[model samples]
Target: MFKTAKKLFTSLKFNYFSLFIISLVAIGLFSFMYDSVKQETYELHEFKISPKTIRSLKTIEDTVKTEQEKRRIENEVTPFYQFDEEVSKTRQAIAASLFDFIIEEKKANIPDPENPDKLVKSRSEQIEEVRNKFKKLEKEEPGLRLTDEAIASLLTAEVSDLTKMKQEIVSIIGEELSKPVRSEDLSAVRYEVERKLRSSEAVPPAELQTMITLGRSLVVETETINKELTDKRIEEEKNAVEPTRILQGQVIVREGQFIDSEIYRQLELTGLLTNQSSYKPMIGLILYVLFVSAIIYLHFATWRTDNYQKKKSLLIAIAVFFILVIIMKLLSLIDKEFDVQVAFLFPTALAPLLVKLLLNERLAYMMTIVTAATAGIMLLEGFSAIMQMEIALYILFGGVISIYLLGNNGRRSNILRTSLVVSVSNILFVAFYLQMTQSTYDLSELSFYLIAAFASGILSGALTIGLMPFFESFFGILSDMRLIELSNPNHPLLKKVLTETPGTYHHSVMVANLADAACESVGANGLLARVGSYYHDIGKTVRPNFFIENQHGNLNPHDELPPEKSRDIIIAHATDGAELLTKHKMPREIIDIARQHHGTSFLKFFFVKAKELGQDVIEDDFRYPGPKPQTKEIAIISIADSVEAAVRTIKEPTPDKIAKLVNSIITSKLNDGQFDECELSMKELRKVERVICETLNGFYHSRIEYPE
Candidate 1:
């Protein structure tokens, strides 16, 4: 069953399809989780009693109320009226024409018929003549029409009073005509003219009364309703009216309260009514999940490594991602349901910390970004866009902090310490966000956010401590912490090597130091190399006297055996060590290093000895069975293992001789194609050569002569 599952997961298709399935699950998770349509359905009838309160799951504009407000403001705006300057001038001209006719009649004084020099007409006779002439003139000019009473009063008034009255009447007519006098306001404008005439005192009371009547007639409605300007002004006011928004989580109706038209409309608008589900949000969520999945796939593609290609490693990352996302979703749901900001309490750093511990740092950074984005999306229903962005950035910063703090230190104490520092970072981030986004900080809000921030970090540490063992066990992951524990001297495997083969144990320790330093020089897993080197010779414990490392000064067991037998014994140790590590449930990487360190290099000494004995010998018979070193660390340990064993044979070691020996062994490994399967570059190989030589010189340097 395990083999079949492994074969199925190893396929490239499985990787792509796994990502597709994850995207689908994510879309479904966001679609149905806390959606308003999934809530209890409410009745749509108006004026009915509500059984329960309903809140909006998403923000939406209340279009009905917005339109009603627009209409109301449109109605409240007064219509625009335009004044007619031409009408004012024409009315004033008519009043002027009447006064001009009276003046012209006065100017046309006729000579007396009885006496040439003296006027023969009586004052009454002259007045009657003037009135008759004015009547004739009034027929010629239609605008000169006035009451006979006003005409007679004007003629009887003093000339100065007449001039003043004419000037006042013309001035009042022009002023009133210039104003915006709509037909509805014409009566008011006429009353205003009469008040002006009475106040003016331009003539006697009787003449003023007569002038008031004439002034009212002279005033005409000179203003008209401007439909274009009126409509434009109303439109401007309507645009200024802000649309009423139905915010998410706002109550639509209270329990046992009447559901009026507005409340019912709001419920329908928010999709709380039965059978009113909208698939728009679901579509958006699907697209979002696809986008995130594509980015994750590209990240993996760019840095494709054998570790990431393993199904278990990929599964561990996926598990961490889903765990963090689920926690975020649950917290967001609580925040929405209780109207609190509990979502801010989510352990945002959990994903990055776990991934960093189990995987590489680059993958940890990817986990940080993806989890932060998912948190932002999950809280979209509960927070504003700016607030969501701030939370996302905060989560991002926290994840980065966690990853950095746990750098190659996956021990429990280090994890907790890193988490404490992450908590401090979280607190600082929240404080900064509050200071930037808020005008007057609410003490309650600040306190809640701070508590959530601090707790989130501690919870991340706790949950990581709880879940790490499961991941390590289920996935057979070789974390740094596990490697450290396995490297302890008290471990059963290491103890077995020490008691049964003390010489081999000492040799293994020396090889470990050499491999660890060389591995680190080339940016490989040095701890894995060191720990793997310790157990690499565990197979020698099976027949302690057979191998020279465990032989000490004792007779070699291979002396009694044939050359082929000796070669087989030497070759069997690689397979034997692999079996022991497998039995002890050691990591695959350590087991591979032990099994492939010797590679297929021929045992030259045994083969030459067999040939010298006049026996038929094949080259293949003297070779160690190997799959070759398949990683940089395994290859480095292979070179280091041979270099350490060979360097011990030197009687008078110096830096120059150690350098020559290291280079020859590396070149021989290269010629034998032992490192062909790994990705160790020539530049890195040279670096490894230099590091090993330096380390050997330190170990085997000439000591100062001491007086005895």
Candidate 2:
């Protein structure tokens, strides 16, 4: 069952599908966190303004207050009035015409004492004539009629009094009509005209009463309300009242204070009332996750590694990413429940340190960004958006520092040193941000942040140190530290090989030097190549004398055995070394080097010997079992191994001889199709050849003999 599961997991389809599932899980976790913080809230009861002041949590305009203010301003606005000059002129003309007609009638009807021939009428006839003329004039002009008594009183007056009264009444009517007269002010204006007429003794009471009646009719409302102007004034007042704005982070209600209507409204506006449900948060989380996933995918697509290593690297990165996210979420929950300032205490740099140590640095940096973003999302609930961003940047700065300081993971103490550096950097960053924001200089608050920064760094180091081994072991990752540990001469496997096959050990060391130099020149992993070379010949320990390197005084062990037996013994070293390395739990990369360094090359000497002895020896039967080198380091090790063995046989090694020997060995390997599976380009192969030739030339340079 375990083997079947292993096979399924190792398959390409299964690995990709598993990656997809992991991505889905990551997005799902983020969405879950978003929902936890931004879920729907509902107010159970209504509230009103009574005994407490109501403040707003979020900035919003008070539409209710604005509307009420508009109404009040509208009520205070005075109605607009306009005077009609045409109405006043028409009324004056009618009054003057009435007086003129009365005077003319009086003149025509009065008895003439100087001329008896003239038709002189009595006072009654004159009054009747004036009444008849008034009736006619009333028909022509509607508001000009008067009573017979008023006409008689006007006729009995002296000519000068009559003229003065006519002028006075006409002037009074014109004066009253010129002023603004609303419908309600008509009677008052008529009374004012009667008062003026009564003050004058030149006019009789009946005439004054008649003049007052005429003034009432003449004082029609000349001014009307201008609705456009009145409404404009009210609108201007409404606009003048500024909208009330509530700032972000402003306190909505104090503790133990009654909730008011405006406070409740603000709570609703800020989504604190919890009555609204929305899918935006969930959608945003999904989009954010997808963006991160796309970046991861792009990194993988662009990475230059073998399929197996690429799969492993991706899996490790995903695992680290989720682990950091979980830690952030946990810290967020604690911060929310305890109301403590512990959110910054999260060890955000832990994942980046682990990734950098156990995986590649570029992948580590990518995971650092992802982890910081996740931390920001987690801290968004209790802090303002600006604060959340600052927290995220804080995490990013610390993570970057950890990655940079921990680049060389040769010793375990580097982790602690990196933590210290990260802590200092975090503290400095916090100090800078605080100073820029001009926050209160409360020592307690500053100390809390400083402590959190220190704790975050130290905790990150501790966690990374503790968890790195597990990740390396579980993922079968061969980190630099693990490689250094394996390279230690005190290791049991290396000690055994040193004791059992001392000559082979010396040969391995020489080969390691050559391979390390060649690999370093081409930008491959020099340490890995050197370490793999150290254990490549461990299988030679089982039969030390059978190998030419370990044989002393040319014992001719191969001469005593048949060609087939010799080939089997020789080929067994590759498999034997692989098995031993695997048993010792060495990295797969080093084990692969042990298994593939020989690369199925034929044992030509033994094959020639067997053919001369009349034995039908198949060439394939004399080859070492090999999967070939699978990386540039392993491939360089294969070439270096052959070059070192060949160069050791040279009696008088010269620079020209060493270069020829190195080129021959590389040519043989190329002809044997040893580098087919790896991603080494032709240009890189040429570079490797040149580097190996140069290194071998230096190793076997001609030396001047000292005269002894």
Best by lDDT: 1
Error of 1 at 649 (Å): 1.4
* Candidate 2 residue spans exceeding 4 A from truth: 1-4, 27-250, 259-311, 336-340, 381-387, 408-414, 701-708
For candidate 2, the per-residue lDDT at 12 reads 59
Clashes of 2: 5
Taking the tens digit of each residue's C-alpha lDDT, what string does model 1 give over 525-582? 8999999999998998877888887776758888899888888888888999999899
Q: lDDT scores for all predictions?
A: 0.80, 0.78
Please report how far candidate 2 places residue 75 from its true position, in Å. 6.8
Superposed by TM-score, candidate 1 places the C-alpha of residue 22 at a distance from the truth, in angstroms, of 3.3
Candidate 1 clashing pairs, residues 3+ apart or interchain:
none
Worst 10-residue lDDT window, candidate 2: 49-58
Best by TM-score: 1
Angstrom error of the Cα, residue 517, model 1: value is 1.1
